[model samples]
Target: MNRFATLFSASALSTIAFGADSYAAMPHPGTEPEQQLETTITRLSPSAYNVVLIESLRDDHSEPPFANVTPQSHEARLVQASVIANPALSRKLQAQNVELDNIVGAETAADGSVTFYLR
Candidate 1:
């Protein structure tokens, strides 16, 4: 009886571990955008980021080249709440006739929120 119980427990443990690994292997639908953005942002210096704002888009998704960037590798979160929260940045960009496409800065948290940066 003890041998049977041990076998059952071991099987249960193996099943749980396998299940956790499978879940981890699957791509997270929510984290995708932030992960991509983080890859792009890390490729730039502060000056480069500013210049990027003035850059044009070939299509709605023709963002800067960040082909091999890794998210969560940066020193900080890539979006700044203050920038998104500020009326001034919006106004400045608007004055330049650049409609705020997104705000992929380096200081925002990822909580599965639809941030302006991820737009």
Candidate 2:
């Protein structure tokens, strides 16, 4: 009868230990999630901005660069690149009196660079 009581007490203690461990391991409901920031640089023209290959930039986790970017979020990066590249293109276009529409396509490079095609 004493042995049976000892065995039952051990089993009960182990069950309580496991329950406490599981509760501790569970994630808390109200924690703030982490946000990933964009680190990609775009080369742009009147056409498309060259984007870094998603496969090359992604880690083993397969998270893509700029994966969560919205169109509005990308405007600042585009405007900055255009400001830099447009001066030269604008000069040539002005000389030729040509007006181009907007960016269209990108040519991918194996070196993780993109050449934006202009119209």
Candidate 3:
């Protein structure tokens, strides 16, 4: 019975996977957008991370490249809020023309700067 259940589950999963991809309109043969990346960075003190990072996906993702950037006082609260109480940063983000509720990715530097990815 255990073996039967395992086989049944595998069969069901394979069916779902095959069905999900069969009707999809994929981009051109070699033009998948998976490799393309867009990233942004913000540095701060006691940086409160509002995003979750997947350790397994690090290889596919690009690291933040905000080195040599001048940290501004105004942008301090942008990436410095604790995960729980960051009302100011939230408000500022909402006011932006392109609101940023959460980041696509983020990296911390040895010098205590943070680079937040946008894509």
Candidate 4:
């Protein structure tokens, strides 16, 4: 009966080691920024600030380019272009052309900033 005892111990240990606690410790499936972007796109108004896109793309960049202003119509043009080009944002931004090679982000001009990804 030692074999049965060993099997039982092994099974118990395995269950505890690879159980609910481990799963709970894991991050939620899609709470990441990328996924959130998709959802937020549907809600973006025509005038979202481009700075938001810059923040999204340059997430790992040491210092993002523009962080000063709010969203505007002029900036919105560039933001739309960036969204159209970015693969990550392509599907959601497909209302316009999708440029797979394009880098998505924001830019600044005299008046304000525009974000391609909806705010």
Candidate 5:
């Protein structure tokens, strides 16, 4: 029937729209950045940098600040906190000697790395 055809079309479009995205659907991404001590921050320009948080860091449940965020967003926020609290990113900042403060955005890779853009 026409309704069935409409449903099939909608389903196909939905699949195509979402199928291309590679981020994992992590329902119970445990913990915050506590155990995740490793992170990388690379300067993209004078005022911007990128932070990379390895997959293991994102394998835990979300914390308070990041509690309501989706898994991908959770990773981004987690990395920011992890690096600041964990020391390596702070060291990188000290070495680079720049004050980076704002979190612009974040992206997840299928290969287990989440990169955050900061300004």
Candidate 6:
């Protein structure tokens, strides 16, 4: 019985040592630096626009060419303009000029990409 107990104790110690070694080798989540999101806008057409979000490691500068330029998000906005006038035989229809509002939608991805939609 004493020999069996010794064997059991040795097995448990080996398991614990193996577990501790693996845990030490594993990378910690806090070791990685935080990423920042950058947004860019592109005009697709006269009434359509595309916004792209990119994740960057640096806060002041963004390296798209060499760095890991992961696209985090994408957003599209459509602009509509119309004229409101009463129906009249003599009245000429005039198109109303419209401007885009300063409203935007944004989303973030797990990889650190951020997408923004502007209208």
**Number of the top-ranking candidate, with lDDT as the measure:** 4
Candidate ranking under lDDT, highest first, comes to: 4, 5, 1, 2, 3, 6
Q: Cα lDDT of model 6 overall?
A: 0.33
TM-score of each: 0.30, 0.28, 0.26, 0.31, 0.29, 0.29
Q: Please give, for residues 25-59, the per-residue lDDT of candidate 1 as tens digits.
A: 88777555555555444332322324243134324
lDDT of 3 by residue, 23-116 (tens): 5756566431322211123223334423333333357557433322223422323433321144544454455432353343345545544445
Better TM-score candidate (3, 5): 5
How many Å off is the CA of 78 in candidate 3? Answer: 16
Candidate 4 stretches greater than 4 Å from native: 1-4, 20-25, 28-33, 45-62, 65-119
Against the reference, the lDDT scores of all candidates come to 0.45, 0.44, 0.42, 0.48, 0.47, 0.33
Question: Measured by TM-score, how close is model 3 to the native structure?
Answer: 0.26
**What's the lDDT for residue 29 in model 5?**
63
Name the better of 1 and 3 by lDDT. Answer: 1
Q: How well does candidate 1 match the true structure in TM-score terms?
A: 0.30
Model 6: worst 10 consecutive residues (lDDT sum) = 81-90
Residue pairs in steric clash, candidate 1?
A: 77-106, 77-107, 78-105, 78-106, 78-107, 79-105, 79-107, 79-108
Backbone atom clashes (below 3 Å) for every candidate: 8, 5, 2, 5, 6, 1
Look at candidate 2 and give me any clashing residue pairs.
46-102, 46-103, 47-103, 47-104, 48-104
Instruction: Name model 6 segments beyond 4 Å from true.
Output: 33-109, 112-119
Per-residue alpha-carbon lDDT of candidate 2 for residues 1-119, written as tens digits (9 for 90 to 100): 99999999999999999999999977677532111001222222333234243335557777554444432444334533443455654454445443323322233345544443333
lDDT of 4 at 15: 100
Residue 95 displacement in candidate 1 (angstroms)? 13
Evaluated against the true structure, the overall lDDT of model 3 is: 0.42
Better of 2 and 6 by lDDT: 2
TM-score of 5: 0.29
